[model samples]
Target: MQPFPSQPLDHDSLHEECGVFGVIGVPEAANFVALGLHALQHRGQEAGGIVAYDPERGFNGAHRFGYVRDNFTKASLMETLPGALAIGHVRYSTAGSKAPVIRDVQPFFGELAMGGCAIAHNGNITNAAALRRELIERGSIFASGSDTECIIHLMARSIQTSIPERMKDALRRVEGAFSVIAMTRTKLIGVRDPLGVRPLVLGTLHDGAHVLASETCALDIIGAEFLREIEPGEMVVISGGEVASVRPFAPAQSRFCIFEHVYFSRPDSIIGGRSVYETRRQIGVELAREAPVEADMVCPVPDSGTPAAIGYSQESGIPYAMGIIRNQYMGRTFIEPTEQIRDMGVRLKLNVNRALVKGKRVVLVDDSVVRGTTSRKIKDMIIAAGAAEVHFRIASPPTAWPCFYGVDTPHRDKLLAAQMSPEEMRDWIGVDSLSFISLDGLYRAVGEAQGRDGACPQYCDACFSGDYPIPPSDQIANGGFDPEGPTTLSDHTAP
Candidate 1:
């Protein structure tokens, strides 16, 4: 089996599958869902959809191929989805075709034996291809090519009397990471995979409405009080402003994705009760301690790299400077579909501060480097702006393996770290020096005092360590991937 086709262009950064938001027992719940989706727009920007249920209107939904603010915020659209219970999804295609299809936009609804239910998911289903083949052989007619639709079809086949029960039966057969938010006429349900590989949080509104979202940032958008994260393998069914919890899977240790703290999550959000921003800064602290370099200034790649740069500067006793500035108004997808424009990609989004970086030995701190194309471009920009030397300090471990748990990573061959040594990468990118935080150092940053527990890792560092918590079943069956043969990150990779 070959690697998945590369994205349309080099989007240097990785993307999580989507973001989900659901609310029950709130007036104009669709409006609240829209607000939550707006806050979660960072997680996904390809498309958005909302499903709402009202006593008089039954179930109504609007799926559009664009941002939530561009689609779901319209008064006409929000009015059509009038209800006290609603669920929404902002999407970036990981399972289906990369091209945006309205049919593939989620908050997917299915009319079951008992009632109708809508589901929005934020993780990849590793065994989806196998599940789809089986379901097709068994006479299941599918609408969208999305792996998420497999869950719906599976639910349709379950011989259960209740929607929640059917969902449980269906999820029991699902493999890979999934944090699901589903809504029925009166009940809203949330569930996380056995490993908790993705995040799902529970919150409560002032009016006692219950909310389930992919991140705490979404909860904050609606002024909801953070309650707690839904436990791995746990399911919560909310109806009449009350939540009922259930554990349908066998007990297992939590292995939430470590990369959430690195790049996927918003800095202001919280994960495992730890502040994400603080953790990222601590990652920078660790990087400074582990890969110290004598430099005149510590400059962040901007936005994602800000906290880490601050930590590095503080630790190394170097002055912090905004050597590079990002265009907040420029969207990541601003490039035209032309080679000339693609060559000018990073320039459109970022620029070096000529005066600040001129004649300075700059240390560039960034979250992670995927293809290395952007890193090379940034380094050239710095040098052309008159920087004497440019060193790179990455906040996370090398992303050598492609993530199968929701994140849209490039194929292994496309990953710079996967194809070359750190020294080789340093030369290839034309940087003075390059270093990535060790896996253990990253664990320490996230509050693991002694570093990653190899015997039973507290977090899923599959992309960095290649130790996948859940086997990528479909890829394995198709041939090429080997879970047991992961390339271990050695301390030497950091020079």
Candidate 2:
């Protein structure tokens, strides 16, 4: 048992997605995984778990509720997880219960006929409900509410004789986005689903140990050299310091999530060989070209909005100032959990730079406006701080639909863009003007020269375009679930 961190203050932003990390052929592998997960803490703050295997100890696991730093950093706990092969997961519960529980924490372990195998997964399983029902009827007992447990149960029921073979069999029967890292007594494995909706990469340490993580930033923290991205539909297994590749799923078009480049990933990380920071900065450039506005100064919402704001300032030749200052020390602020207190989060987390924006026409740049609640509050704060005008420039296209693959999002009706046009949103938020980068412009910024291909999109822009590359099986199975109802896949199934 462990202490659960304070619940994050509710705000208009996408929930943090999960992150996975693994290492093989290294001493104190769990320690390395801890550092990697620390770098990925931004992706998930709810809970974390790690599983390691040693010759004598076999499989040792630790599951805790809260940030990796608060739990995994303790030497007393890390000592018990001694092994040369380890894998870990940081979770935000897109596919499980919202309330914190050790059972829902991941790097789920199972004792197979071949050996004890552990798996850590990033991304959601769309078909988890049906799979879980079938498994339960077949007498499989579930230990956690996470959809990731479906894969473990499938592996357990596989007819294959080897762990990797069993994993292949299990994944073949599954559908939806996944980038998985798994471990056996002698091997470390990584696999990305055919569409590649989530990011995963391979890295190598100086001592020749291989690392697999959801993002390159995790690799950076462990001083691992990124070898390459694990390709879509490809599975790589590392044993005895050697890596082998196999394609377990049929080849399909790649649809990596474009949101990773927009807001989910750390700007310092790389995706598809392009720098995420550079892409966001380029997004600002595109936004400027599409919606040039006359303003005294351009300001960012701060933190996530900084890079794009810099690019906007550079492209438009407008003097950029710190119009809004963020309180960097603030972590979770829902200790009171009052509705009024929740509404005060924007003020507590951010403050307008009164001296900088006293009477200036300030253009406020932010990644995206989800519910418009936070944006409205920010605009009011700027107005109260004496800003003459407030314009909002969103770096990504308007989020019109909820994401089904890993990202935690509200239902269709709750989304601001889904209900109102940009002009209406501007009026509702009381901003002087509001604009979001065009879908094609976002594609161009991310290196798609001519723009997004309508028939075969280069990336998954489902949240923006409402074009899901993979059919959400369970949602469809739910008889095209009511738009007004709770929308998360987990909400429709048993936890």
lDDT of 1 by residue, 1-495 (tens): 212323332367788879999999988999999999999999998899999999998999999887787887779878899889999999887533566678988989999989899999999998999999999999999899889999999999999989999999999999889999998888999999988989999999976699999999999978899999999999999998789999989887888899999988999999999999999999999999999999999999988999999999999999999999998877745747787775677787899999999999999999998888788889999999999999999998888999888898878888888988999889988999999999999999999999999887888887888877777789989875764466342221100
Candidate 2 overall lDDT versus native: 0.87
Cα TM-score per model: 0.95, 0.94
lDDT of candidate 2 over 1-495, digit per residue (tens): 111112333536797668999999998999999999999988998888999999998899999987788899999999999989999999886533466778888899999999899998999888999999999999999988889999999999899999999999999888889999999999999999998889999999966699999899999998999999999999999998899999998778888999999999999999999999999999999889999999999898888998899889999999989989888867752365676775566777899889889899999999998888888889999999999999999998889888878998877767889888999899988999999999999999999999999867888888997777776889888876533343332221111
Residue 286 in candidate 2, Cα distance off native in Å = 0.5
Quote the RMSD, in angstroms, for model 2. Answer: 5.1
Worst 10 residues of 2 by lDDT: 486-495
Best by TM-score: 1
List runs of model 2 lying over 4 Å from the truth: 1-9, 95-98, 337-340, 480-495
